[model samples]
Target chain A: MARTFEFHGGVYPPERKQRSQGPVRHAMLPGRVVLHLDQHAGRPAFATVAVGDSVKVGTPIARCDGMISAALHASISGQVTQVDRHTITIDSDGLDAWQRLTPLEWRTASAEERLTRLEHSGVVGLGGAGFPTHIKARVSERQRIDTLVVNAAECEPYITVDDLTLRQYTSDVLEGAQLIASLCGAKQIVVGIEDNKPEAISALRQAMAESQPLSVTVSVIATRYPSGGERQLIKTLLDRDVPDKGLPADIGVLCQNPGTLLAALRSVRDGEPLVERLVTLTGEAIADPGNRWVRIGTPMAALLDEAGLNRAALHQLIEGGPMMGTPLADLEGVVTKTTNCLIAATRKELPPAPPESPCIRCGACEEACPANLLPQQLHWYARAKDDAKLAHYRLFDCIECNACSYVCPSHIPLVADYRHAKTRLRHQQLETAKAEHAKHRFEWRQARLDREEAEKQARRQARLARQSTQQTDSQGASPQADLRSLRIAQTAAKAAVRKAEKNLARAAQQDPQQSHDDLETQLATAKENLQAAEARLAEARSAGEPQETP
Target chain B: MSDAFSIISLLSAVAVLTALGVGFGALLGAVSERFKGDESSLVEQIDTLLPQTQCGQCGYPGCRPYAEAINQGDAINKCPPGGDATITALADLLGRTPEPLDGEAPSEDLVAFIREDECIGCTKCIQACPVDAIIGAAKQMHTVIEDECTGCDLCLEPCPVDCIDMLPRSTPLAQWQPVTYPHQMIASDRRASMEMPHGTHL
Candidate 1:
C-alpha cells in the first residue's frame, strides 16, 4: 500500500461482522414493487406506461428526463397497477417475462456504445450517492483520467454487500474495472479495502494476477469508519488531497462502487440491464441476517417478513448502514436501485436514542468529526439561524456521517439537528433566488412603462409640431392676420353699398308724385357698385390656397 | 545676551512643531492611497443588493438604472419586489437608514397570460414588454416567458382586444416556509425523503 495520510478526528465503533456470515441469498420476487422515478439525484422521471399496461423485467417505464438523471426499469415482469407522483406500482405476474437484451461486446465496442449501454442499464453508485454511472464514466476531454478507485471499504458497521461481491464475482468485478478504466482512459486501477477483509483482498489479488494487461493494485489500509469516503479513500491510498468542493476526478481519479462496476460489466458483456441488486438484510431483530440478491422495488415489509422480523419487539427500521441511516416510517416503502441495506432492529439490539442534554463543552465531537468542523459551534449557529456564521464555519461540508453524534456523550442528536439546519438553509437560498428573479421582472416592467410613457409624450409633441407647420404652409399669410384684414374689408364694402341704396330710396320718395326716372337710374348705379364690391370679396376668399406650389 | 538666547529657543520650538505636522500629514496621505478601494465596483454591489426586477417602481427604468440612481443618492426603499428585506439589505450595504417601501409592494410576481381566443392576433403586448419576455411576431398570438416576466402591468393597457391578463406566478416551494418549521415529522414528507444510504447532508 502507498504511504497513507492521517485524517483528523474519527471514532472506532465495535465492528460486528461475525453477526451475519452466511453466503449470498437470492430473494424471491415480491407480489409488487414500487419504482420511484426520483430514486437517483436530479429531475424526477415521468412515467411512460399508464395504469393497467403490461411491463416485463428490464422494460423502461420512465425515461431519463434530465442531463443528470437516470432512467427507470421494471425489475420484475408485471402489470402497472398505479402510477402516482414520481412512483410506478407494478404487480407481479410471476411469469418472469423480460424485454430484449442485446449485450455489447466490451472488447469491440466503441466508447459511445459502452456509455449508452450503461445509461440504459440503469446502473448508479450502488454503495453511496447512486449518481448516474454513465455521467461518471466519461470525464471531460480537458481531464485526463489516470486512476480508477474501486471502493470496497465496507467500513460502515453491519453492511457487507461489497465484500460478498468482491468474493463471489471477483473476475466479473475485475473485468468491469478494466472496461471502466479503458473508457475513462485510466492507466492505474486501485482497489481500496479495509485490512480486516483478508479473504476479499486475496481474491482480488488472485484475479488481478490472472488479468493480462490491466495495471490493477489492491491497497489494504487501516479499518476506519469513513475510509470509504471518496476523498478519504483517495488520500489514504494515493496521499493526494482532493481540494475543497472538488471531485476525485479533479485529481485525475474516478471512484466507483464495486457493485456498480459489476452492473456495468453485465450491461456491456451480457447485454443485461440492471433490474436487481444485492442488498444486505441484517440486524438483531431479524431471524436471518446476511447478504441477499434482492429484486429492485421489493417492499421493506416483504424483506422483513423474509428475515422473520419480530414485529412485537421492533423498535425502529433504518435504511442503509447504522452510522448513517434514515429512520424509515413506512414499511410499505419499496426498495429502489440505490437501496443497499435495511436494518430492522429491536430495542435490545438497537435501542432508541437517549434524550439530548446540554453540551458540556467537552471536545469529543471535534475529535471524532472527520471534516474537522467545530460541531458545538455549528450547533449554536444552526439553532440561532445565523446563515453567515454557519457558512463561515463551512456547515455545508458536514457529511452527516454521524461520527460526531455517535461520539457525543450528550446524546444531542447532532446529526438530526444539522440535517434540519441544512434543509432550512437550502430552502432559504431558493427563496432568495426567486425574490431576486421577481425583482428583475418587476424592474423590467417599470422600465417598459417609463419607456412607453416617454414615447407617447414624444409622439404627441411631434403631432403638435406637424399641425402648426401645416397651418403655416396652407394659409397664403398667417391665418389670424388674413382673417382680420378680410373681415375689415368686407364690413367697409357692405356699409358703402347700404349708404348708396338709402340715398336712391330717398330720392325716389321725394319724386313720388313726379316722374321717378332719376331715382331709378340712381338705384341701378348703386346696384352695380355693390356687385363690384362683392366680386372683390369673393376673389380674396379664393386666393387663400397654401396648396398652390410657390 | 539673555534676550538673544530666548529668541533662538522660540525659533527652534517653531521648527520642531512644523516638522511633526508634516510627518503625520504625509503618513495619513499614504495610508489613504493604499486603502482607498474602488468606488465604481460599488454599482455592481448595489445592483446585487437590488432585486433585479427591472421594475421601474424606483422611478428608474430597470434594476441597473435604479442601482445607478441609488449610487447617486436615490432612496433605498423604492423597490417593491425586494420590499423591506431588500431595503434593509441595501441600507446595510450603503450604510443608510432603512426606510419603508416607497409604494405598495410592486405588484406580486406575475406573468401576463394572453387569452388566445379573444386575442386579435395583434402583437401589441409584445411591443409593450420591456424585457422582450413576450415571444411572437406581428399578427400572431403572443405568450409571456413566465420566468422572465416582471409583472409590471405594462402589457395590459396596450392590448387592443382586452385579452391580456396579469396572473401571479406560483410562489416557489422554498418561499412557502412556515414560522419555525424544523423538518417536522409530517406524514407526507416521511415517504418523500430520499433513501440516502449515507448521511442526509449532501
Candidate 2:
C-alpha cells in the first residue's frame, strides 16, 4: 500500500480549500425550489406528482423510470408549482416536518433488503458522479470483489464538503463502508484519503478504533489533481489497473465516495430518504464561505444569499470544482444530489477565459493531458469536423478533465471544442438513423400500394375478358337464361309495334283527310324495326361470343 | 536436303506463333470479363445520393428513375426537394463539376397542409400523389399525411377546391438548443482574462 503508481500529466492549481475552516452550517430554507429530474447520469425520472398537489419532505415526487434512473423526492414540504420536461418546481411552506421512507435495520438485514432501501431512498453517488449507489454496490457473481475503497480524496480545489462530512460523521461513514463491503462481498475494506487532509484522516482513525469489529484500514496518498478520480485513486492505493473503459469492480475493487457512504448510512440507520446534502459554498465574492448542509432543492441564489455573496461582483458562477464545473446559466437553479461545490468567483479570483489565439502547434497540452491523448490534433480534427479521424484517435476516451485547457498557451477552450464536436457527431448519427427509417417506411408504403394497384388491374382485365365472351348474353350464363332473355325481348318488341299501330289508327281517325298514308308508313316502320332487332339478336348468337340457346 | 529442313523449321515457327497469339487473345478476353463490374451498381450509387423524396421535381417519375437517367449521363441538378445539397452530392458521386440547382431549389422547407374547410370530396389529389400520402374516399374530404408527404406539387393541380397548400414547415422544438456563436468574446473581457498567474493559463 506504500508504493503509489503515478498516472500521466496533470496541473497543480492552488488548492484553495480554506472553505472547510468553519463548522458545517445549515442553509436557510428557500421559499421556492426547482429540482431537475435528470440529476443522475442516466434517464430522467418519471413524474409521480402533478401540479397543485401538496408534497411533504421525502415524498416521492418522481419515480425511477428505467434501469439506470434514480427516483426523486420533494426536498421540502411544498405545493407543486410547475412541472416541465426538464425540471419540477415547488413552492415551499417553510415547514421542517419530516415524512420519510421506511428505514431498514442494516446490521441484521440481508444485502438485498439493504440495497432495496438504498435505491428507494434515492441515494446516489454524491461525489458529483451522480451514479445510483445501489447499482454500484451490487456485486455480480461474474467477478470476485476483493476490496472496498472509500474515496475521501477531496482533490478538487474549493470543494470541502467531503472533508467536512468525514470529519463530522466518520463513524457513520465507516458503518456505511462496512455495509457496502458486505453488499459487494469484499473481504478487505480500506479508505483512501489524501495526506493533505490530516484532520479527516485522524477522525477516520478515531472512528476505526471505536468500530474495531469492522476492521478497516486507511491509506494516505500524496495529494494530486484528479487523484480523486476513482481510477487514479485505485491505481495509487492498490496498484491495480482498471481495464480500459471498464469499472473499478472489473479488477475486484469497488470505490465509494465518503458523501455517498454517509448518505447510505443515514438511509439505512434512520427512516430518512436523501433530501439534503452538504454543499461547499465558497469564492472571493462571498462575505462568509464554508461548507453547509443544504437541502437538495434549495436554489443556488438562496444559498449564495445566505453566504452574503455580492452578485454585482460576480464575474462567473460555477457549479462544482474550479477545473471541472459548469458555468451557471441560471443562478436560480436548485441543488441536487450531485452538487458538491459552488464557486462564486469575481473577475480577479477566477478571471474570464481569454479569447483563443492560434494553436502555434504547442505540445504543452499533450504533456498536461492525464489521459495522454493528442489534444492539439484532436482540436484540429474537431474544428474541421473530421469525425472519422477524431474517432480513429479515440476522441470519446477523453475524460474532459480540462487539464489540457489549463496548460494551453493559446488559452483555447479545448474541452468546449471536444464537447461541441461530440454533440455534432451524435446529432449526425441520429439524423442518419432517422433518414434510413424514413426511407424504409416510404419504400414499403410504395411497394404495398403498387401491389394493390396491380392486383386491382388484374381483376379488372379478368372481368373484361369474361364480359366480351358473354356479349350475346350480358348475364353470361346457361341456355335457359339466354332463352328466357330472348323471349322477354320478343314480347317487348310485339307490344311496341301494337302500340304504334293503335296510335297511327287514332291519328287517321281524328283527321280523316290528313295523311292516311303517313299513319300506314309509321306502323310499317315499327314492324320492320322489330324484324331488324330479331335479326341482330340472331347475328349476335351466331358470333359465338356467348350462347344461352341450343 | 538442307532446303527441305529449312522449310520444315519455318512451318513449325509459324504454327507456334499462331497458337501463342490465339491463347493470349483468349486470356485477355477472359480478364476483361472478370474485371468488368456490374453497371447497375453505378445506378445504385447515384440513387443513394438522392434524398429519396419521390417528389419528381427532377422531371422524372421518382428518385430511382432519375438515378437511372443520371447513370445514363443525365444532368444532376434537376431536383428541388433534394435541393443544392443533393446536386452537390450527386456531382461528388459522379465525379462531375458541381453545378447550381436548375431553375430554383425551394429555399424553404415545405409541408403539404390541407385546408379542411375548402376541400371538395373529389379525391383527385389522392390519386395524383406518388407517395399515396393523401387519405380519403371518393366524395369524402381528403387530408395529407404530413409525415409521409413529399410535397411533389402534382397534387396541387388535381385538387378541385385547391385546398392543399404548401406552407413552410417550422422547426421542431425538440431539436432546438441555444446557439453558441464561436469567436464572439468581448474585447474588454478578453483583455481582463489574459491576466494569467503563470506562463501557462488556467
User: In DockQ terms, which candidate is top?
Assistant: 2
Task: Give the range of the ten consecutive residues with the poorest summed lDDT in model 2 chain A.
Answer: A539-548
| Candidate 2: residue A174 Cα off by (Å) | 4.2
Model 2 C-alpha lDDT per residue in residues A1-550, reported as the tens digit of each score: 3456787777788888975568988988888878888898767888888899998888988888777779888888979999988888989887866787666788788878888888888889998889998878875545689898988887888888888988988888888888888888888778888888889888987888766345788888888777887777888788888777677878999888988998999988796888999999999888899988888878888889889989899877888988887777558777888989988888788866666778998699998877768999999999888878999877887888888888887888788788788777767664454444345444445544544554454455456646766674456432322544655765776787799789877886654434454345445555655554454344334433444343
A163: Cα error in model 2, Å: 2.2
- Per-residue lDDT of model 1, residues A1-550, tens digit only: 4456667777777776766668888887788988888888666776799999999999988888766778788888989999997689999999988885687778888999999988887778898688988878867444778899999988888888899999999999989999999889888888999988888998988898876467888898889878887887888888888887777888999998999999999988887788889998887788888888888888889888988887887766888878886668768688787888887867666655544567899989998888878999998888888889989988988888788888778766677678778888887676556545555444434434544554454455445545756777544342322645656755775676577678767765653334444344444444444444444444444443333445
Top-lDDT candidate index: 2
Q: Rate the local accuracy (lDDT) of all candidates.
A: 0.77, 0.78
Could you tell me how far off, in angstroms, the CA of residue B87 lies in candidate 2 after the best superposition? 4.7
- Give residue B5's error in model 2 in angstroms: 11
Error of 1 at A186 (Å): 1.7
